[model samples]
Target: MRALQSDGAAVVHRDERAEGFVLLSPQFKQRWRFVTAHMGNLHAVLDLAKVADTLLFVLDPLDGWDSTGDYYLSCLFAQGLPSYALAVLGVPDLPQKKQADAKKKLGKAIEKRFPDAKLFPLNTEQESLLLLRHLAAQKQRHLAFRDRRAYLLAHNAEFVPSRDSDLVGNLKVSGYVRGWTLNVNSLVHIVGHGDFQMSQVDAPPDPFTLNPRVAKGQQKKGQDMEIQVSICPHSQQSASVLMQPRKQQPLQSEVIPDPMEGEQTWPTEEELKDAEGSLKKRRKVLKVPKGTSNYQAAWIVDDGEDGSEEEEEDDNMEDEDLMEEASQVVESSEEEELAEEECETMTIAESARDDLYDEKVDEDEEQMLEKYRQERLDQMFPDEVDTPRNLPARVRFQKYRGLKSFRTSPWDPKENLPRDYARIFQFQDFSRTRKHVFRQLEKEETEGAMVGWYVTLHICSVPISVMESFRQGMPMVLFSLLPHEQKMSVLNFVVRRHLGNSDTVKAKEELIFHCGFRRFRASPLYSQHSSADKHKLEHFLRPDAALVATVYAPIAFPPASVLLFKQRSNGMHDLIATGSLLSVDPDRIIIKRLVLSGHPFKIFSKTAVVRYMFFNREDVLWFKPVELRTKWGRRGHITEPLGTHGHMKCHFDGQLKSQDTVLLNLYKRVFPKWTYDPHVPEPVPWARNEQQLFMQELEME
Candidate 1:
């Protein structure tokens, strides 16, 4: 039963309900709803924040907020924070002597993260009521990532199965539409779940409509949202299905490459006769096979006949000879992180009475220790690999070629790209494309369901298990995909290493990401974040320095924040890094460097003889064009080889000491691994680390 108005004011029913309710205030004359959620629940807090107009954080009076709270706060700030307010409960319950001190300490703590935010003491019901008044009147701050897209916070979701299949069904999700108008023909991506097409949209009655409350009063009220047409008529569905030619967007993520559809067309008799009559003298540009087409011949010309292949074969033969004595062992470190742990995840028991001493031993402890030592060694000697004493240096380091200068040296981004690069997309000008997309979105007035409209989307092909998960209280968020946003592209993110994570993170390692409303796993290539066109690749993610993380992902425009996470053995995902989207440029050059160190055989004024750099005379001559350097701050070059056994005379700007090591810096372009997965495993939900108090009766006998 609803509460009757008393003295010209609408009041809530005395009975408590699980569902959220909107407040109808007589003092402020406004309607509002309160969405309360447990801060410790990871998915709950984040998914709710996405569609929320305002957030009110409740802090403890004694202690502001713990480290765990701070961790989630950083995530919210990075993902995009809407207008928020802070409040402290139980402030008046504190002792008179400690109340002032607690308030002062709380001010200093919150000042760091929220300097301008006013701290409200909300112990009394009256104060809490006043807080809502201020919150409703305050202006809201918009998140750039969410402002231009249509999204829904799933308040009520139900799966209606088709008669043919129980597994597949149309998921009817209802909620208020936020952001820009949502087009019915567009695809919607359910967070965590994959993208699905909408069958149709239905306008439903708003559950939180407060118009009935004013009907009980004596005064006439203004008309708010009225539920006119319940289900959309059949006429509108035809218009949505058969949209204008230009209005329809294609769902193809990749362009199909066809070999049979080339320029191998047969010439007609009329064309052949005309060519035979007119062409007395014709130039044969390229010599191709009998059935070769123009496209295949172009590739053949670009890749010269035998000269380059024979040269590469000779180099490979020489390289193989050097490493004939020994083979390097390669394995992925942290096997637990690489492979999924099948063991049961352990959880903290609730009560002290059920105390069970938890003791777990790591089987690979020694391997982890050795890996840490190797990481330390790499840090001390950055990229320095010792010369193989048993084998020739040319074979061990054949894959690398020396660079004159990492910054100034020219390396084409298109050269030596892997096969996966062909399947990816590239943008001519990302900034201009972004502007045009946003400009088109602003013209959404002619189509789509407008904001604040209570509409249900018929998400086709959603599994029944998704609805079961929704019933279990998992946060459900759905976002409309923009044009071409679902296509694959090389995405670059400007991120800083998360300070909380001390474990070593390296390039080309698989990591889970939360970018805007999408979560996925991808292997990213790391490079120095710089203004120059060419960027030096980093083997390890460094602290206190920003790095550009390049990964193959679906195209998302800039202004989206990125949160990087790595899975732990216990099934929890740890936040390792955070930043924002940089760009979608596939042409950015990232060069990986390998250092070859050699000892100075003999030192002289402006000249020195170096050994162990190359095993054969042919190897020295091939790399003579490349530059060299010494450990003691000297620049040099290989003038000529003194002997066949890898001894080369070098000229330097300054005299080199005998103890100084001769170094050759070789570089090659690096690319991310082809391991882009959209369905990232859901991590163990966040739980509060509650302390249990144990009491024992006096041990007396």
Candidate 2:
């Protein structure tokens, strides 16, 4: 095996016998685009998966089936590719029984994951040729299917309106039309924009090259050609923002102020007496000895000579005790009298007899009762109290309720959906959308002029602002459109309120908002606002604000031949997202969706002897203790450093054999940062510059 120094090591084997046969036999000649993908490199797998027509998964008996291999298998299956096959590599001189056992074990493992896939032993040249023939047959079938589908689309072509030019008269709208036979006079219909006559056709240069295998004499003229057309709509297509349902805020209970304050209602006489009796039963008094007075305690001698001062102090103390007794008696008597008076007043107030002299008291009582009733009414109808006579009796406010999982839920094509539900976007004429190519375009391009291999459109109609977000580098996507028969009624509502100074102030008091895939900006529809409005706007700037805007985003319809949608890109597009089929109906289909791309992570082996590519020692250290997962659902963690080279010791729940793979999952938050030059050669190497060397050394340290 000859090792190639590239992004990763690639092994090339040349058999002398095969070389001579190749020189002699014309049919034996072959060309291959060999790529060596490092384990755990999802990006490399994704890139290679796009170009590879068939997958050949090689399992080594000595190394065994590891998590790394399993991950690649899962990725391949997920792609829903055309063909799959497996090859078991082992020593040619190994015992026949041992080889048979190894093959059997590997076959069982592959069967568990991919039951339909064919397995073969890679022992001799004949076996290798058999695998090659199998792949070639699968490729032929795939190409035949694609050619037939392309022919059908070309024969019955349809163009859906994707974008319109800004010019007014004879508006030259540009969109992609599948179905090949479009001529100068082809008539087309634009859904709501009305029927129009094609004025000119602008065929884009074919992006695909001619097949090298086709003999010069047998080569067909104008193969794989696409034409861009310019046409004028009878009337300009109306532009409207597709709105999603706004989330509803939780209802807040009203706060009512206390109306009766300061005044106290005295308890009835009987109730007061009962209260006093309970207090007496609960109170305890301690007795004091009669001879233990302050005067007696101070007198140490009992002599009668000059004892007159002591006698005076004793008399004073006796007088103070009498006064305290008198005060207590007076307080008890006063409380009894107050209680009696309160009872008398209540009796008088409850008396039905009308007396002229008691009119003043009755009037005061009536006034108090009226005030209490008015306060209750105000609490019940706070809004009514402030509403003007001209205001309507029923006031409706716009409401929004957040969805737990918006992708799988049924949403109306006409109603506004929450921004978070804007996971999938469907472009009507996806082929015409500007694709960003690394190489410069031959002609002058607009801001969103580069046609990407994939076109993304929101499943629901997006706002003009969101549609314009392409300028801000939002990813372009093509969503699987919903079928017409599956369409449902969507509730769309718009509430306009004239917040006169009072409403604005109240709204600004404590404002809260929601932000997700959608953005919110103040509309110009409302009249001038006070300082409170500005404050409310500032409050929305917070990251956790729950504020959302309501705009009508129309639901997009899926293009024809939904199953064949994958073939639309013709190997040029990348599968950046995946969705699970929720339910299918005669008219509609529901899907649970997620954006496919994420940050890239590395996985290291847990074995004592590590044999894989690593840039430096620091790479190993940084990955230490990081959790690694196997494809079969087992997990392990890196424990310690293995050596000076980039290797580490890892521990798993169960002892891992040489065949077990340890992988670390990483994600990509933004795709543009990870973009590569399409025209650049594969396995791009690090430049041998001072800066590169320094960076490499820094990683090592």
lDDT of each: 0.72, 0.31
Candidate 2 least-lDDT 10 residues: 560-569
- Cα displacement (Å) at residue 179, model 1: 1.3
- Residue pairs of candidate 1 with colliding backbone atoms: none
The C-alpha stretches of model 2 lying farther than 4 A from their native spots are 1-25, 28-30, 62-64, 93-97, 139-701
Tens-place lDDT digits, model 2, residues 1-701: 22111111111223232121101111332223233444543334543443344555667774456655554454444434445577766645568778777767766886798787777766765676676556545642142112101010010122233355222223233222221222232233222122233333333322221222223454346432221222223214432222222331211111232345334798899999999999789654433334344422322222222323432332233433434554475478669978975664223332333432443342486575565556555445331222122322122111222122233434444243333223223334332332221112324231221221111111211223323322332222111111121121111111222111011211122111001011111111111122221111121112222221111122212121101001011222111112121111111211212111111122223223232323234554544423455545565444444444334444444435546444453211110011111121122211113433443343334
Question: Where in model 1 is the C-alpha error above 4 Å?
Answer: 1-19, 25-30, 93-98, 123-125, 214-248, 255-366, 389-396, 685-701
TM, every model? 0.76, 0.26
Error of 1 at 252 (Å): 3.1
lDDT of 1 by residue, 387-455 (tens): 665766567767787665677767777777777777877778988998998888777464868887767
